[model samples]
Target: MTRMPRRSVALAAAVAVLATACSAGGGAPKPKQIATGYTATPQQTGAPKDGGTITVALTPGLSPNYIYPYPPAAANGTVIGRGQMWRSLYRPSGEGDQVADAELSLAEPPAFSPDRKTVTIKMKDYKWSTGTPVTADDVVFSLALLKAALKESPANWSFYTPGQFPDGVSAEATAPDTLTLKLETAYNPSYLLSMLTLLYVMPSAEWNIAETGGEHLDFKDPKNAKAIYNYLTEQSAEQSTFATNPLWQVVNGPYKLKSFDPTTGSFSLVPNENYSGPGDSRLDQVDFKAFTSAAAVLNQFKAGTLTVGTLDSSYVTQIDELKAKGYSVYGAPAPARFDALTINFANTVDNFDKVIAQPYVRQALQRLIDQNGYIASRGIYNGAGSPNYSTAGSGSPYPPAFGDTPPYPYDPAAAEKLLTGNGWKVVPNGVTTCENPGTGAGQCGAGIEKGQKISFTLASANTPAYVGARDVAFSSAAKKLGIEVKIVTKALNYMYANYGNTFAPATKNEWAMQDFGPLYLAAGYPSSNTVFNADGSFNLGSYRNAEVDKLINESTFGADEKTLSAEVTRLAEDLPVLFFPTPHTLVVVKDTLSGPQSSFNALLSYLYSPEQWYFHS
Candidate 1:
């Protein structure tokens, strides 16, 4: 129950005029889906013109890392999954549901090869605000840069892999308006489609400097590769600078980046006039305003200053209050982005070989806790949630498939049975101990110095969802097994301290488990090679399973989904990070915000075309 500020409301009213004036002859398009709460009659053709600025409030803060499109980096993926960026290729009508055949931004629907090894994208004539044509060269440049970064600066590229482009796969400009990717093998076409969906096609002309090495690679040199990388790297959300190059061209999506001011923390997006699509432009302008507190956002919405913004955990309990105040509150499900307990198994003394190595122990650990009750208590946004295996497997070995047999059920009895059956013995006070199968009496079990205690501190952000879910669920479940779990909450910076190459051996040892969300997976396949390598930069939990490692590598270059699934199943059976729920993103937009909900990766594309959004007078 916060109120919108007067300045914000006045600004919004100005935006309404700007949007209507700009709508002119270019009428807004009717989206397949309408706003969940607020009902606004559609703007007439040639009525609400495309133009003006609409202000929005982006979360915690915007990191320039936002650049990673479709197949998002670990950080950027979090934003896309949150529904900030819109998708152009495979947009879901609402939330992260089933994908639509085609979206307004795509020139033509995506096409796959017979073997599903290659995907070709035909660029629409949509131009960037600067009036440059978006071409395949831009696409090729982006992928090539990704491949190069993965090869050279692995620590930086730890979130993603260039395996998407195998030995035989290469990107080339098939035509002025098309980009074709020839894959090395047949795999899930969804992977490529997903990656491309969020990728912002930057002008190759602007980024080619990064491709030329040596003399042109210096970060200080404006014309060098360093300069290009610096631009992208500096823009990462970590820096919180939302700068845009007016010279940049965008041919693949609906709207263009209008103005971005890092100083004021405000941005404006305008519609693309050349866009070829169905219905388009209900609003003339979208103004994005930044607020440091959720309270401020709620106030603005309540005051009718801002039409759209997200509610934070603190306000989650007040949905009824907002509704009673005549506010249309739409609750969508969010993806299981950071809901995990990532154990840095590499440093743990927990008999990885004898205890964790057992498949049943892993399953037992997974089943001992009830995820349903935890989600219910927290009022997890949407009713949509599923217990996930380590490999995003909830029902089926695959995701979104919802397989028949739920992988692991919450059963402490079964967990105890599995442990005792596997050579573990129960002591007097719910504690369990195991003897060194090979050693003498004093070597293992409780009260003996032979074995160390199986307890460690868990580190995560202080964010409500993260701290609340992780602390309650993990601690309760672990305690049942005589394992002492200590929870540590830190600021975002300190929490992700070990993100890439910046981890300390001592710090790594102090903690056994941490919370982590996967960077966006192109095809949504799980590969832990770059993530779990013994010395790999992102191997935060230090959990290592040669078997799981091998499987991940095999799946990375696997010929197809079946081949990859087989490997994934093997890894899932050997639980690494106690994968819980892989939920779809839940975006709560105001009733006045009209457009498609969202699918897996099309969130960004939706933003680019908000002018296509209509509002009632």
Candidate 2:
């Protein structure tokens, strides 16, 4: 008998910070402000009742791509929609705690080999909607197909490196219900299990058409790999009509797509009677409707048309009005996400590389940022936010002891002193110019030429009314320290494209800093390896530090929390990215709905436990 590892049980704390509440009129009283690190519990107004339709409002639009959970480009709606049909090996127990416990969904908790190189997973006795039994072979086939698709989309398989599949790691069916995975590398058992949370099982019989002529098609073969990937991706994309698609009709989860309208971004889901999951869905029907703006969603909530909706910081002031209208509001700080001002270290224009590279300069900038003031200005509900000093952000799975303490207080005088002492002439509320250029004390740092001015362009997404206010505050604060900050607002897509692109010598420097969040996803295990590593794929700022790189790499495979905490502490001190207030996720639900639990997986919304939700009548 294989003993369950302690690390595996500790995985229960994997739920990251991510939540909602309402008030009556009288100019809508100030929304209750909650501090950071608070975990939201599901709203309990009444006992669960069966057979009711809950209409959920989503902003922007539903995903155009078919609801394929594995693809990196999968939309938020697609992920939620896929969750309704496809079942993962483990599911978050909807208990409304800060740390969520992983319960068996389709398979039992995996048993590990003594050497920790192998994981044995046993499939639960479950059947798909098509009356097909979910077996170990299905798990093997799903892993094989994902391994093949990795070449086509590296982001989809971010946990592993190129050519690591089938060689560094391999999976096989040892028994009809038992699947075993062997890894060439000895990784942290906890980290490995966290990564498996992302692995969603697909039907082998439905998706295995790529294998032709009875010959094993090696995904390593470029031509064959491309063909197979295209075939799978296209099938997922073409699933426009949910009811007509034979492939989508067969699901293992509690709900199935009853109707989908791609144009309006509206869809309806009905309970899957054949689902073999832990609990039965109480709702008879679920509808997802798209809204163009946050105000629209709020209006729908006030009208009692939407059972659930999200409120941005702009709407925080309206908490009373929502409550007056009879909506329950809930709020909590996001766990994996935080907004920050990211400086481009690779930017060579205007001596940006020289100025931003200095620790003193970055520290001075940190001192100028009033995170608490920014939160107040936004009327951020429920004290729902807090200053994020490290890349790990608030609500991380790691211990608080590992997080960094704020080194710089909000003091413009101190900021000016730091700059002036460094041989930069102080010009309060204006651009400061370098007076001395040398490595010696009281001289501008190396590579910074005399007369170089402290100035840079900052870009941010146009939406969210608070971003503009935050930009203004940042600019005003920098001005007091003689820094010239030009704020530019652009479409979120344009901002993301420019901000996220890797630095190139031939490319023109677009913006020096970007304001966005919560930057990293908790699914990656709160490790700095993927976001802060010198060679990280998502290291948009091109910030590189040898010490940081080493710590992050070690933390990726380090089993102990001590190792991980050390890395977080180091990053907090280094200030690779300027910290900002973590935005709180506020969700509004109708009094009629019950069992609306939060999950680290869906940080921005309350769609984690739709199956458990029901209308109280």
Candidate 3:
């Protein structure tokens, strides 16, 4: 499909976040206070009974828009359907490990050749709704389309690095059920497997045509592949036809697109009777109801109209009220995810690019985030957030020392000093202005002129509630350092679609900072290829550092497996984006509904397993 810089990221999980943190001070490290109140997989009660529709509440403003696997924006930018209508070749792990789920995966674990230059994948015993075996041909067709889309634009897939992946590799269905890729260079098993997780196998027999109702052609031909990519993308764009299109009905996943509301982006899914995977379709259908506002979702929960959904941290205090309504409230920091205020270095508004380009300035801005305070503040995370310092949030096997100990912990006094040291005249209650113009140790960085103000808008998502609450908290903290931090609230979808500087250059100056929630890397291997590489498609802020790039390369290519953690540690200290506490997403699911606990794990991206769920007594 489309791509991530070197890794794949879905532009979602704006699900409420929480984290763990150590104090900023030099003394004995403050006890690591990551709240443990919320569990990812709470024990389900009751015996299963078959066939009931589960009306799930889609995150407000974060409904399905693009139906194609290759998302065009932030979240490599947003994948439509996987684990539902279509299944990825390798399923991301729900347990937050750096591996695929064997039971749900469409293929066996990849077997790498001795030199690690080749990968062989065997298809599982699965078939499409049309009774055709899910084979290597489908995988080949999918990758061909992915390559064709990437040729059109890297925006089609955020995880792609220009010379990596489908670029030099040759893929084919060696056997009817076996797919092999002969890579020009060796790659880490984890990294390669993670990439495969985004490769959603489509019904090749039905979708291989270049035109509507056209004859199927050999997709192996580059021209035919390109035409097929164009045709599928064109169909995906017509959201109204998502359910009715005959081409969309030949599914292999547990659920199939039943109906779609072009308006509100809500849709219905029915059981795919021919889904050849673990678990039965105990639920009759699933209605994903979308909302214009988070408040509307909250109202739905209050009215008991929402059977399963996530509640923002701002509404966690209403747990008892929700409990009275038979909903189980559980929350946790999503695995392989980190929440942060993505600093847009391209936004030249108020000389923000020049000002923020300085290492000291970014450090100062990061120092203003009161992670513990946010957890302690009822207005924000309300004890639900755990401070996270690295891109590989909590529970990741490889978080640098800085992961637990923030390099720039909350300190308003330290922030002011950093500005003053950088030749800025600090005003406690007024706007701070640059007093030095040179690119020296005692002067503001290069291109920054005297009297320049450190001011930029922090575009925050209005849904998750904590996104706004925390951004406001940061804005207020910046005021103390003479930095003008303006908080502008926007919908998650608008920010996810329009806030990226790399994709939407026209709106480059619209926002200097955006907290559209966390960016999830490939399961198990959280590489920062596209997200941090200078030439990365998902490097929205245009963060560039030669050393950082080297580290990412070494991890992704070099034999030193430990290099990945080193890369993360370096990013933590470097401050590519201002780090925030990872808050626990408070899920409110009616206790009467039960399923595999792994299905609700937030770290697994937008994947959900409703097929395993059913209303029980």
Per-residue lDDT of candidate 1, residues 296-382 (tens digit): 777876776766555553345455456666445443323213245665555544543344444565676777656654443333322
Is candidate 1 or 3 superior in TM-score?
Answer: 3
Off by over 4 Å in 2: 1-47, 60-64, 72-80, 92-100, 153-167, 211-226, 239-243, 378-383, 395-397, 400-404, 502-508, 523-525, 596-607
TM-score of each: 0.71, 0.85, 0.91
Candidate 2's TM-score: 0.85
Model 3 lDDT per residue over 1-617, tens place: 11211110111322123221222335422222324444456565578998888888776656667677665443322334556888889887755566578888999999988899888989999999998899999998988889998888877776777898878888889999999999998887787787888788888899999888799999989899999888887787777888888888888898888888877778888888888798888988899887766678788999988888877666665676787887777777767778888888888888889888899998988889888888776656767777788887778876786545677888888888888998999988797898988988899889999889988987877656667667776877788777888777776667666877667878889999888876777657788878898887788888899999999888777766788899999999899999888877677788888877777663235467888777898
Clashes of each: 81, 15, 31
Question: Which regions in candidate 3 have their CA more than 4 angstroms from the true location?
Answer: 1-40, 71-80, 602-605
Q: Which is better, 1 or 2, measured by lDDT?
A: 2
Model 2, residue 99: distance off in Å is 7.6
For all predictions, the C-alpha RMSD in Å is 11.1, 7.7, 5.6
Residue 198 local lDDT, model 3: 70
Q: Candidate 2: worst 10 consecutive residues by lDDT?
A: 1-10
Arrange candidates by lDDT, highest first: which order? Answer: 3, 2, 1
